[model samples]
Target: MTIDTTKKIESLIITDQEICTLAMDVIESIRQDFNNVYYKFLGGELKVLWSNQNKFNAKASSSGDLKSPPDHSVTLYYATAIRIYRDGEDLYDFVSSRLNKYSDLFEKLNLGEPSCLFKDLEKEHFVKNFFFSGLTYLFGHEIGHLVQEHSYIRRFFCDSDRNLNASGEASEIEEIEEIEASASSKQLTRRQSLIWHVTELAADHEAITWCLFELVRQAQEEESIKFSQDDWHRLKENTLIFSCAASCVHFRFNGVKAVYPDEFPIGTHPHPMLRIEKNVFQIISGLEFFSTALGINSSKAEISKYINKGVISANIFWIEKYFDKNDLDSGLLMLGGVINNENTKKYMGLIVNEWEIIRECVESIKRYKPFNAGNQDLGLMFFDENFKKEFTK
Candidate 1:
């Protein structure tokens, strides 16, 4: 199992010398992967860039090719790269002990006692995979924003609001004033906030698609690695859950919280748990779709056995970072009480409903195609009309 750490191809310009060499390598891997992914799904290309602003942030928007059939930029800031590197080193081989049911599956993740390598190199590889997968989640999220054309839609409505507010109707100027209105930014109205939540969740939905695909690539990187299709299916399900769980923990580390939040997140972002559950739904739904298409048998319970592992691992990392070992019991008990529940299902419905509400805006203005279809998109889950219909029904 040799990794070509020195392997290089044309990728993002590395301006952040503060980012560790290993971390940059991971970013390069992602850049190469995205080159194929974007073309396959979006029928377009993107320019990847690195920004060293010393902030743990990333963004997507129109690039210099903002002409017809424009290309976009997905920039990863230095602070975020540094954090990804450090977290990979810090959380290699981290998961809850409550996963004996699929212990073998995890071992495939290089998560067990090192049989060959001394001093925990297997665990190191496991964390490296985790970090890279988490990073794919982040990078794919920004791509989600681009593919979905969220910024264009936002600007359209924002401009429309400005015009409407200027030409006040029915003496609404004073009323709009008292309502704490501001067409200048995102603080204009409740509906604006709701739109924010919906778009962010949609971006997350797109992110998981890329994240799962990248995991599959990483698993098969070694020529000797193989699995029975059944074993491989379970591996995809379990590892995607764990990888996304790690990313969600990282999300929480970035100040996103929602251990037991309201049915709807009160901010622009969905609750961290809600986002995690949404990701799980994508995994199970995707597996179900694959099973149906491939004529295989996969049960909900079978595919779901490893669901709690991510929560357990998240609790361990969160408690250790934010609390202490003493709170581990309570944290594990409390961290994931809402996942896979009826409440989450209903809340997910709301997200779909909101997306469908803006589906026309997305369809009318999207700059690219994705496994293109008129009514459904398996590649970008939430964009599929049929899935939205059945899902919300």
Candidate 2:
């Protein structure tokens, strides 16, 4: 609902072909980046499902003497929607209503501010927005579940109804298990429930990264007259961008604050000041401004100034407990080196070094306990590493 003068509505809208093309390109990149276990861990099997302006409609028909129910899959439903029917009418009805409500919200919100989920389907980037910004990001969350291996551990912790959904409505123990495996990998263990929250965060971070890419790409083609003119700055501030990925990031940031009171007394996720100070804002800002690989003439001095003034957004307690300070500090330094550029790709070599350091940091963090390969922790590690590497280097 906020107004943004920076974006042109036309620039934000991509044609159906453009959307599919970009989405497929993104997906292909993902496939290349992830393979086998990593792919499975990252919810790879789900792939990218594209929908045209052809609205999903449920129809009733009689195949034989008996009338068949609606074809739910074709309808606007989650990948989890199929199980709703078996759980009984209540569950089915509940999901149906929820989906409809969200659909309505999508319409009402008109998140056409490029990369927002509510972008109209008739537009081009809508599919890309849904896939890269919305779905892929969320799928990464599901990958978090896999990383936790919730299912394997579920046997030891779960009660008798291992098949039951969280609502305890139906006996989809296997279906639920498979869905969990396909999306989140496995059900969460009692001790690992919090991991689910992290997965959501991880997904958010991934989604944000991709969204940044999309936003940057969109900005470059602005002069072409093919894109929508939705104000990018306004869109950035709308908060809906975080509704999925950022939402999880916020949740875990809060939870980690509560649970690890001593270690993360302030919080797990970076605080607003720190987040901005650390150029999380600028990274996003950079992503917002640098719409093309050709690069844009933008000022990052304002961003650098902010980060330099803030308290170091690092918690030594947790860093010592879960990460080696030497590695962690080195990682940050490497990232800073890359993102430190004034505007041009001046720090390309440093960016490459940042990537190496970040990779090591990520592997180290994943090997640690509590987070022991949990979703958000790894996500945080990756986010810190990649952004720092890409931007500054």
Candidate 3:
């Protein structure tokens, strides 16, 4: 949890091809969608691979500069990929072992017995499918960074002498926007930090939506696995569950104080729990994004169950895996405190407001007609009528 990733120490690096191959397989599984939906959309070749770095981290970077075409790379460190895979399995085993006590919870969420669900396939399918979704998210997240073309690449082309304000002509300090105001250094520093936070969240939104729809595309098109109506529903449920479980695993690595910057200069990425919890809304919108083409027809009530129970699943695994605690009630209580904290609410508002402010910037440049991650430009606010109803009804 405390290893410095700045420098690569051969003593700590794990270049095991097998460990890296699991992530590769996930990319391979979704390659069809990846290429079809993102090839030209991404601007250049997007290379995703495993890193030998020993840290529990992943990063998106590029090599070319202003003179040359940029090629983006998203590398998942071996330590990060391996831990996420293992932690995901551990979380599932922990919950499955306690199914007796949580039978009501499982039944309410339509969670099928792992053994039964995978009986037609390999026993490990339960772990692989859900964990693969988690892995898919990690890869997609890096790609999400590339899709945004945020400050990282802004220096090359965004030569405007003005902030990309969403509405007003006011000056702002954010993402290489060229600070034009006489704002104090502290205010600029603080606002820059906030912009970085919003930048990370925007990528998270893109990645999570990419992840859900990719999962939808994968599940719908899978020819190897035939599912009955009930089994199809269960598959959808677990896909949603492990997506959150993956967030818990990430939180386990990043620590829980990530709710807000005041919690301690939370860096580019927000805490995984806050990222996980609020993204249920994103998942809802994402399903709607792909529902028409994919024929995803879950009701408002069923979608509600997925989000409610997903929170329960994430809280349990987060506490058990991170705090080394097992009391479900206590875990839920702790989660409530984290979510309801005034600072967290404030941080949430910051992202929402910043999102609106920068909406024009992203939409103007983003090439649209997603197969359907950000299906369209204004798809920023909502995916469709169904997405609107999920919240309204």
Highest lDDT against the true fold, candidate: 1
Cα deviation at 169, candidate 1, in Å, is: 25
- What Cα-based lDDT does every candidate model obtain? 0.52, 0.31, 0.51
lDDT by residue for model 2 (98-212), tens: 3333333223333221222233223322222323433333334333323333222332233544433433344322111112211232344433343322232333344344444
User: Which of the two candidates, 1 or 3, achieves a greater lDDT against the reference?
Assistant: 1
Local error of candidate 1 at residue 28 (angstroms):
4.4
**What tens-digit string does per-residue lDDT give for candidate 3 at 146-208?**
556564433223344444321223333222211111111333235555666666566666766
Order of all candidates by lDDT, from best down to worst?
Answer: 1, 3, 2
Question: Where does model 2 exceed 4 Å of error?
Answer: 1-44, 47-140, 143-191, 222-294, 299-380, 383-393
lDDT of 2 at 380: 43
Candidate 1 — which residues are off by over 4 angstroms? 1-19, 23-45, 63-67, 93-121, 157-188, 217-246, 253-258, 263-265, 291-298, 323-336, 339-350, 372-375, 381-393
RMSD (Cα, Å) of model 2: 17.8
- For candidate 3, give the lDDT: 0.51
Among these predictions, the greatest TM-score belongs to: 3
